[model samples]
Target: MAARKIHTLIVGAGQAGIAMSEHLSAVQLPHLVLEKARIAEAWRSHRWDSLVANGPAWHDRFPGLAFPDTDPDAFVAKDKVADYFEAYAAQIKAPVRCGVEVLKVERGPGGRGFRIDTTDGLYEADNVVVATGAFQKPLIPQVIPADAGFLQLHSSQYRNPDQLPDGGVLVVGAGSSGVQIADELNQAGRKVYLAVGPHDRPPRSYRGRDFVWWLGVLGKWDLQTPAAGAEHVTIAVSGAQGGRTIDFRRLAGEGITLVGRSGAYQNGHMAFADDLARNLDRGDANYLSLLREADAYIARHGLDLPPEPEAHVIIADPECVSRPVRDLDLRAAGIGTVIWAVGFERDYSWLEVDAFDAAGKPVHQRGVSKEPGIYFLGLPWQSRRGSSFIWGVWYDARHVADQIVTQGRYTAYDQSARARQAAPESAIHAAAGDPDGPYPHPHL
Candidate 1:
């Protein structure tokens, strides 16, 4: 006889999974969370020791829990954040099977539910949620020449400055991670170079208030409404601002050298783009101008704001090489480390659903997909500003969880086989290009 089927199966056991589990328990929904590793694996394994969330602690809590800290503006370190997740999972007694990797999911035969095959075992569920976040894949550009002799590592593998070779270090991305790592390494007495890019810029503090406070004030943290339709659009556009995050202006003001986008490794020296330094300087100027404009607008709106804070307190070291990689030979120059602070990519090979549109993202309004009993969370822009953050997932999770309870009951999803058969072939045909195309079409 076939094994008993589960009611719901949620992929991943991180913050998003916990949020979904909390809601499922409240509604007494039968479900289980499948995690390939221990809970908070990414936080535990990938992040550096001194790393704290760029956002404040209060803004980092998941659903149904709060981060206890005397200083609201305090940055919660990586280990602490990991512990918080573990505690949250334990507190809720979330139904999770750790170390269980889900390899595939497909529509069940007869359309009753779904067939989920994992590394550990196989199971079926009426509904499934791919809560795995977009960070599953690390992205590196192929444009960089392969012959660059320097050792290159993604930020994921970086723990501290001690791993660098005897020579200087070159960081290839100037995003939040890149900037922070560059600062840390530079402080550790290693020669560091930062490659700058166009990133969102905000102040460390604005009007004597933490950046997160403005987010709350701006209703960026509001999640009472189910994010669907236009509300979703509003959230995306607003959140893309990175919550007006604090930039590295203060650091740069202290004399850190910033370069441009392109870099090549040659005889022991890293060569940067011809326009890298100039572009970086221009970008920095543009960023300051934008902030000043916002400040001016605030004053114009008759807002009683305190005097503007002085510019940044720290600056990077100035004793840096000037030539680009093409001009300098990296191997001969003995540059030991190359840090790829490049961004992440989204991978969804395990999901066996027809919901994804072009570019391999599930087509969902809010968290619900066109396929019944299917949902997603922790996406880059699931609904609003906080969708991807720990705190943000709570709102999206609650909405998606409630949706599952309301639409995922056994009776609600009990489509009759005959009715499913009579349905048009259009639905299944649309999935033809999908790797898990609805072959033997299970319609119910």
Candidate 2:
């Protein structure tokens, strides 16, 4: 059978791909979205059962619509997020084919367009938007002993406390997931040990606003990716308990023992770093930075809002973080389970394109890859700090779709970009209707 042809093919049905579909459809552009599972599979299947969106409902959505009948400050449950994406996709009339997994994506015969191999069948497309999102595979460090006798799982696979064996639980990585899971297990009367790391601890609410509101007000979400060292630091904010602040000392006083970073494992013992205080301090610094920024913004604008006393009250590091536990004997601690929440890394090995860098990450200029007819969406810091957030991903998805529509290159925006590239560097600036030489597509 001849390969199915599409003008534009999208390889995800999450927020990014769905948003891209909406933009393309708005302009009457023909496209189809393909997903390995149903829309927003990660939200539906990967996350823990009791998990809620890290962002509140008001901000955790596409620009076109607000979450249905949900309060602005409410942190919608994980299932609701999936429902929102599905509803949004339906509302947009996005043509998505579920259970269709793309096995491989390679250049078509004679280097024209793309040949996609999928479980359903073959497809050829003029352009492909790889919107598989940033969280492709879970990253579980090899810190667990090879012959450990404890039940272990990644945060993605964790459900409720009852899903694991009854004894103590050790939750690794101090990011949002780590903290929340540890807290939940601790609350359930389970002995919980949390492996802390360098993380950003911001209050859920400051003054009269949610922290997300402050981020938008202060323009932190739109800030460009920071320099090397701090770009990948874990953000440890929670939307639990009606969006309360995350205080390590409070957590410690409540019974969750915080340990330093986990390293190697040997002889029924897990070695932990002695830098717990340093990690907590760094997170505390991030916490304080937001307060100061908010204080300055309020004073500058002469806003009526006053500082939130609870948000400003600085708490000292808990006892455990100060004098870190060096080695934890699994048996002695009665820890029967380990939840690894170390985050994820991208996996695009199936995409047979020469558009990746040395570390196998996509190389793109504002979502448009150097490789013609190829694009990426929902990557961390793709354009700014909020690139991975729901709203940011939608924002980015539109830009990518715009690039496709404007450039009209391979599928013909006459992809004047190629002709421009071939033209003499001197002729680039003077090209008709293209005042800018270097970056011709400036939708910004």
All models: lDDT? Answer: 0.68, 0.87
Alpha-carbon runs more than 4 Å astray in model 1: 143-148, 219-255, 263-305, 309-328, 409-444
- Summarize candidate 1's per-residue lDDT along 273-313 as a digit string, tens digits: 66554544544564465456546656777778776555423
Candidate 1 lDDT at 184 equals 79
Candidate 2 lDDT score relative to the true structure: 0.87
Give model 2's clash tally.
Answer: 5
User: TM-score for every candidate vs. truth?
Assistant: 0.78, 0.92
In angstroms, what RMSD does candidate 2 have relative to the true structure? 4.9
Q: What is the TM-score of candidate 2?
A: 0.92
Query: lDDT at 282 for candidate 2?
Result: 85
Tell me, by lDDT, which candidate is best: 2
**lDDT, candidate 1, at 71:** 59
| lDDT accuracy of residue 124 in candidate 2 | 98
Tens digits of per-residue lDDT for model 2, 1-444: 789999899999998899889988986779999999999998989988888988988888888788888998799998999999999988888999999999999999999889999999999998899999888988877767646788889898898899999899999998899999999999989999998888888878888888998999999998887757986788899898777778877899899998988888887788889888888888888888988999999999999996576666667766786667899998899998999999888899899988899999899997999888899999889999899899998888878888887666333324566777788977766765455533444443
